[model samples]
Structures are given as C-alpha cells and as structure tokens.
Target: LSPADHLVVVRPNYATNIETPKAIGCAISYVDLDFDQGFAIDIEHVKAELRPNTKLISVTCPHNPTGTMMTRADLDALIALAEHHKCRLLVDETYRDLSYGERLPAAASLSPSAISVCSLSKAFGIPGIRIGWLLTRDPQLQETFLAAKEQIGICGSVIDEAIARATLERRDAFLASLLPEMARRRDIVQAWIDGETLVDWVRPQGGVVGFPRLNIDAGFDLDRFYTRLLEEHGAYVGPGHWFEMPKRFFRLGFGWPTEAELRGGLAAISAALRS
Candidate 1:
C-alpha cells in the first residue's frame, strides 16, 4: 500500500480532542465540519477528498466534544462514496443510542463496505469496562482486526466484560433512567451558559459533552482561564485548543459529573469568567 493511500477522517470527531491539520495527521486527510451547522459532515467535501488510493473513511455519530450527529442522508452518501471508491468506511457509533431522535441506520448494516465500531464507554458511563467491538460483513477484514487485537492482546479485564455484558442486557432500562438525569444536567449547564456573558456554544444534539467558546473578542485566553479555574476553583473544563479550534472553546462534560457537582463547577467557571 502506498504511504499516500489516503484515509479520509471526518471530524469534529468523537474521541478526537482538536481541529487542525496536525491534530489529525497527514496520513489522513481531515474533513472539517462546521460546528455552527450542527456538526453535519459535508458529503460533497468528503467526495472531493476521495482519491483512488483512499483506503478508509471514518466518522463518529453523537460526536464527542461537539455532540453532533450524522444524518441518515449523509450516511447514505458516505456508503455510496465508499462503494464507488472501493474503500472502507469505519463508523464509530459509540454514542449512537444517545441521539435526540430516531437513530440513523448503522452503516455496517447497510453495506459490506461499512465497518461499525462501538464501545461500552461514553453513554454507558463505563470507561473502566474497556470493552469495544467492531461489526463488518467482510470476514477477511474481521480477521485482520482480530489479528491486530492479538498483538494488543485482550488487555480488557474479563470482569469488565462481564459487567459490561450485564449492562448491555439492561441497556434500555439503564438508559431510560439515565437519560432524564443527563437531560436535566444538560439543561442546567445550558442555562448557566445563557446567563453568562462570557461564553456561548451551539447546543449539543446528543451525547454528554458540549464545546463552548469563551467570548474571545472580550480577550479571553482559554488556556490561562482553564488553568486558573482548575487551580483556584478546583474545577475542570476541557480547553478548546486541545480540539484544534480557537483557544476560546472549552469542552464541558454534562453527563460525567453529578448534577450538583456540574452546577457547582459551572458556577465556578462563571466566577472565573467574571474574574
């Protein structure tokens, strides 16, 4: 395979912390998505990035940090593009169940060209249970992925898998109870942001995270701001610079912390902003 074999990476991606050329790397041509546009993947841009040497195309739904989703039509277009180019499309649907509306169809379910990866992290709130899996119709690719795992071995604890399986068995019930609490926490954070004059963001459509930008025109230096917030207020918010955007943006986790703690953190952040 040529070193130039292009791998199209769609972002603001789930799991990716930033948005610059180096943030993604040269092996993969990064396709930028607009945060203001609900983080939709631009199909035309994706098409333009395709080369005969392109090997893989990857995407995330209920995207991390931004919490945006890929619509069904966009996904359909991606599948078509992959088939047309004879490339593989890797879809990370880790947060798929957390979406706001009818879930988009799994790309792997639609075609052999699509590969879907999922984990028990994020929405399941079980990072400790490091079990994740991929689904693909191609036996050869599946064998390849499994072979790669042998090199990595099964570092995931069996205990973790057992617990994760139980959680999966009760997934619907668990999410039904969890979603309300998460939604409430999200609302609290949104309200706090709305009241604050120093920050703003496009509201996330799904998932536990949101990326909000500090009022940069007001001379906000997010790196320093986050450092002071952590050191002085004992609060943590992910800096946007970590995700390759303007330093004004910071990632805020709404589902990870308890509502009370999230509120307190937001209050601390507001105080820091004022300072």
Candidate 2:
C-alpha cells in the first residue's frame, strides 16, 4: 500500500475505531450520505471523489450510528465502479444479520475485486471474542491480507476462535432468541425519542445504534448538556463530534445492556433533556 493510493471511506461508519485507511498507508476520500434522505450514499458523489490514484472503496452496510442500509442497486453500482476503475471494494457487513429486509449479496461473492469483512462483535454481542474474518475470492489478495496479518497479531487466540466457532454453529438459535429482545429495545428507544420535544431523527431501519439531532436553535452548548447528563443523571451517550457531525447530533446505543438498564438510562436522558 502507498500514500498515493486513495481509499474512500463512508462516514458515520462502525469500524472507524478499528480499521482506518491512513493506518494502512492510503490517502482518504469520503462520500457524504444525506441524513435527511435516510442516509443513502449518492453514487454520483462517490464517482466524483474518484481520482487516478484511487485504489479502494469501502462501505458499511447497516451503517453505524444511523443504522441505515445501502440498497442492493447502490451496492452493485459501487462494485461496478470498482471494477471499472481497477480498485478494490471492501464492504463491512458486521450488522447484516440484523437487517430488516433481504440482505444484499456479499461484495466478495459478487466479484473477485470485492472484499467482505464481518465479525461476531456487533450483532452477536461478543466484542470480547475479538474474532473477525475477511473474505475474498482472489487468492493473491487473500495471501496479501494474511501476510499483513502475520506482521500484526498473526492469528486469533485459540480460545477466542473456539468460542467464535461455537457462536457461529448455534447462530440460528441464538439470533432467534436475540432478535425479539433487540426489536423490543429498539421500540422502547423509538418511543422515548418520539416523546421528546427537543430531539428528532430518522428511525433506524436496522442494527443497534441511532443518531438523533437535538433541536437547538441557537448554539445550545452540547458540552454543557453532556457533562450535566453524565454528572447529574448518570446517562452516557456518544457525542456527535466523535462522528464528525454537528454538535447537536448524538449517537445512542440500544444494544449494550439489559432492558431495565436501557430504560433507566433513557429516563435519565429524558430528564436531562427536560432540565
């Protein structure tokens, strides 16, 4: 990889904390998705970002924070563009299993130029497992990724892999049990948001996170609001600045704790908002 190789990334992405293009020696480009339009990526905008040095395109299905999914047509267009440009397309499908509608075909399954990465972290509630996989039909690319991995962590711990394998083996039953709980929690969060007068958001179509914008007309101090919420109400939600968004928006996670905890947290947040 070289700095001259431009790797385009979608923002409000889940894997931002982990896989960064700059870390891999690639220049970065970004395609801004329209939040008002369900956060759909504009294909034309993406094409406009492309330059002669562009070498890769990356996207997250069931996007982080907003939980918005890319349409099948949009994904196909991205894959086609990658093929036309002779660049790699990497699709991160960490939340694909939690999606509402028919899941799009894995990019790796579509073309040798595409790569797919998935993990047991988000949907499976197993971040501690630290097990994730990259899929590609191209043996050369696979070998190259493996070589890179060898220079890093080499391989996952045996125990972690065993647990991950077990989780995969019982995935159907596990998902069956978990889906209802996630759905229920999502509803609760939605209801709470609906009841709020000072907040607005596009309902998430899938996944565990939602981004809501605060109705602050004239420079309401988010730092003050967040600090007060944390100190007085003991409520914790991620600040929007972390996602490169306007300070009025904040990321809420509905998947981390039990229903009781989630409710309590929401109540505290609501109280903070009212105050």
Candidate 3:
C-alpha cells in the first residue's frame, strides 16, 4: 500500500521496522507492549487504535531485543482482526525458529491476510549468506513484493543459495545442538539480572536478547549514561533510545557471548553502574 494510508507500529520495536515505514511518509500510530506484562501487546490496544484508513498492522513474534513471544490466541485474533478490517498483518517471524523448544505455526499458514517475513541470520546463525524470504497468499501483494525485490537486488548468489540449502537440509541436527545452548545462555542472563538491584526485566520466553529497565530517574540523559558505560567502562550495549524507548531502558543481548564472557560483561556493566 502507498504511504498515504495509516500504519500502526509497535513501540520499542526494531529501529528499521519503525523508521523505514515513517521515512517513506506513512502516517504512523503506535501500540506499546508493556514491560511488566512480559512485553505483551494487548489486542484491545489494537482495537482502540484501528482506523478506517488503516492499511497495515505490523508486529514481531518472539520480539527482537526483548525475546517476548506473542501467544497463539493473540496471533489468531490479530489475523481475524486484519481479515475483518481488510488490512495487511505483517508478522516478522525471524526468531520463530529459535523458540525455546516448541514449534510455532507460521502466521501466513493460518490466514491469507497474514504476511510473514523471515531470515536465517538470527535463527540459524547464517547472516553472511543474507538469505531472507517473504510469504503471503495475496497474489497482488506477492507480485508487488517481488517487484520491490527486483528493483533492489536483481537476484542472489548461487553459491550462497547452495550453502543455505545445505544448512536447511541439516537444520534439525543443527538446531538440536544450538537450542539447548541458547536456553542455557538465556537462563544465565536471567539469573544474573535477578540478582541485580539496579535493573528489572521481563525474562524472554523465547529468542536471544531482552530489554531491561534501568532504574535511572526520569529526565536523566540515558544517552550520556550509555556513552560512559561504553567509553569509560569499556562495556557496550544497545541503548534504549536507538529503539525509540526511554533512555533508562536498554537492550541486553544475552545469547551471543560465551558463558565466561557473558559473566565478565555483566560484571563490567554492574561495575559501571556502581561507579
């Protein structure tokens, strides 16, 4: 749809998702998922925010930087709502494959109105290939998306395609080894956050990272605190402002570093706060 139509965006969401849409001049409205409810996005909020001219409703399942998973019931209701409203429901399922243990049903599979976008980068640890795909049952949207892809990249590399194919062929075996380790890392980070007095968070149900609320007061320049944490303390993290969140809320990427490195980094963060 054109930029003239209204779009509803999720707050504290991935920057590109929010900015790219706004950059193109789409009229924007926001629905913030609260941290206290484990970052749950209430359906009533969506109902209240829906407009007669609304063209798109965008959301992420197994949310980025927060690791919150939208319940199946909520997802189904959203699909039905989009159907009733005759608007597109775009669900970014990049992290769906990395769910703690259970398999998740793709939104597109349940409804023709659903648009599902996914990539192997975060889920399978294969970003170098840069392979991603979009799925939709709407022929017109599918045609439009293909046209957009053509304008951007005429095609992809054969070698990368072959590598991706090989990776997927062994997907089960690979994920078998990877998921448990991720769960371990997630737990470690959770335990560490639990012990910290300066921060509180809604632990992730699935996915690799989480957004933790820093206890800094309102009107404080979280940007300055984040800068010092990086420059003077030799610690780096995703500052909340980057996600269009308050300065006191920062993203904690708990799954990437090794156990020892994770512990060390957490200690460094703790030390920085103490100072």
Candidate 4:
C-alpha cells in the first residue's frame, strides 16, 4: 500500500508492521488488540475504524512478541469486513506452522483479495536463507508487488531457492521435530514468569517468544535494567522499546535457546532482578 493509502494495523503488532507503514506515511489506523484479553482482536472494533479510502487491513498470527493465534472465525470475520470495505487483507503468516491451535484457512484461499506472506525463517528454521514467498489471487496486485520487489533487486540466490524447496519438501519432518521442543520451552518460560514477583505476561499460545512486563515500582528504567541484566548477569532479552511498546516490557525467546541454556539465562535474569 502507498503512503496515501489508509492501512489498519493490529497491535501490539510487530514493529515492522507499524513502522513500515508509517515510513511510507500511510494514513495508519490502529485497532489495538485487547491485551488484557490475551491480545484478542475485536472484529467489530476494526469495522468501526474503517474508512472509504482504506486500502489494506494488515495482521499477523501466530503473532510476533506476543505469539498469540487468531481463531478461524475471527479471520473469516476480518476477511468479510475487508471485502465489504473494498480493502485487501494482508496476513503475515510467518509463524503459522509454529502456532498450536485450530487451523485457520489460508486467507488467500478463502478470498482473492487476501494476501498471505510466509518465510522459512520461523517455522522452517532456515532464516539464514533469507528467502520468503507471497500468495495472492489478485494477479494485478501480485504483479505490482513483484515490480516493486524487482526494483529492489531482492531476488533470492539459487542456493536460497534450493534450500527453500528442500525445506518445503521435508516440511512435516522438520515441524514434527521442532514443534514439541518449542512447546516444552514455552512451558519453561511460563513457569519462569510465574515465579517472578515483579514480572508477568500474556502467555503465548505457540511460537518461541513472550513479552512480559516488569511491574516495577516507580522510577525504574527498563532500559538501564536490561543493560544491567546483560552487563552484570549475562542475561539478554529484547526490551519493548525496540518494538515500540511501553518501556516496561521485555521479550523472552524461549524457542531459540537450548533448554539448559534458556534455564540458565532465566535464572541469570532472576538473579539480576533480585539484585
């Protein structure tokens, strides 16, 4: 979508989702996910914000940072709203394979106006390949998007394509092995968060990360706290400032580390917090 296009963003969205549109100066409309309700998106609230000039309604699930999944019914409602409003639905399905829940139909399959973008990075565990693909029934938009892509010279190298192809060929094998471990890691994270007196979070349904907020007394600098966690205890986690959320929040990556390492990291964070 262009700068003049009005795009609706689902929050606490991935920063890229929010920033990219703003960088283009799009007339950004936000429908903040009700964070208190496990980050649920309200379809009626989204419809209430729609404008005649709206061009796209963008969303992500299994969502970034929060790792929440949207129900199929919710997706259907969103697609219907997009259709009625004459706007395209843009879905970032980067973590779709990692999500644990009832399956939602590919938005592209459900409607021609929907576009789904996916990459091997999250689920396929081939982020280094730096390759991703898009699906769209709207061939005209597909062509236009490709033209923009072509202008950027962003074509994947041959090796990247080969890796992506092989990964897709063996997708089930990779997922079967990876998913259980991810679930286990998430459990560890949940337990760790539960143990924290001054930290709590919206537990992620599936996917690797959780964004927990530090319930600090007034005068706490989360930026400094994170720095001290790194410098003093060797604990490293992403702060919410990076994602444009309130400074009290921090991201925990449960899926990326080995279980023992993650345990050690969490303990280190606990120690740092206590200090």
Per-residue lDDT of model 1, residues 1-275, tens digit only: 24556678886564442233234453667798676666778899999988878888878887777877777888899999999999988888888878766788777999999999888888888887678888999989889988889889856678987898899999999888887777778788889988988778778778889888777565556666778899999899877656666667778998877777888999998888767
lDDT of every predicted structure (CA atoms): 0.80, 0.83, 0.84, 0.83
Compare the candidates by lDDT and give the number of the best one.
Answer: 3
C-alpha lDDT (0 to 100) for residue 159 of candidate 1: 92
Kindly list the per-residue Cα lDDT of model 2 for residues 1-275, writing each as its tens digit.
Answer: 57667877777665552256667777777776666777888888888888888888878888887888888899989999999999988888899888766767777999999999999999998999889999999999989999999999867799999999999999999888777778888899889878888887778777898888888768666788899889999889989877777778888889887888899988887778767
Model 4 worst lDDT run, 10 consecutive residues: 98-107
* Candidate 4: tens digits of C-alpha lDDT, residues 1-275: 67778988887776777888889888988887655787888888889889988998989888887888888898999999999888999899888888776656778889987989889888777799899888999889889889989998866599889888888998889888888888888888889888888888888876788888787888866667788899998879988778667778778888777888999998887777767
Clashing pairs in 1: 17-243, 18-243, 18-244, 19-243, 19-244
Tell me the deviation in Å of residue 10 in model 1: 1.8
- Whose lDDT is higher: candidate 3's or candidate 4's? 3
TM-score of each: 0.90, 0.94, 0.95, 0.94
Candidate 2 residue 164 Cα shift, in angstroms, is: 0.8
| Cα RMSD (angstroms) for every candidate in the order listed | 2.8, 1.8, 1.6, 1.6
Model 4 misplaced regions, further than 4 Å:
none
Give per-residue CA lDDT, model 3, range 70-125, as digits (tens).
88899998998899999989899988888985656998988889999998888887
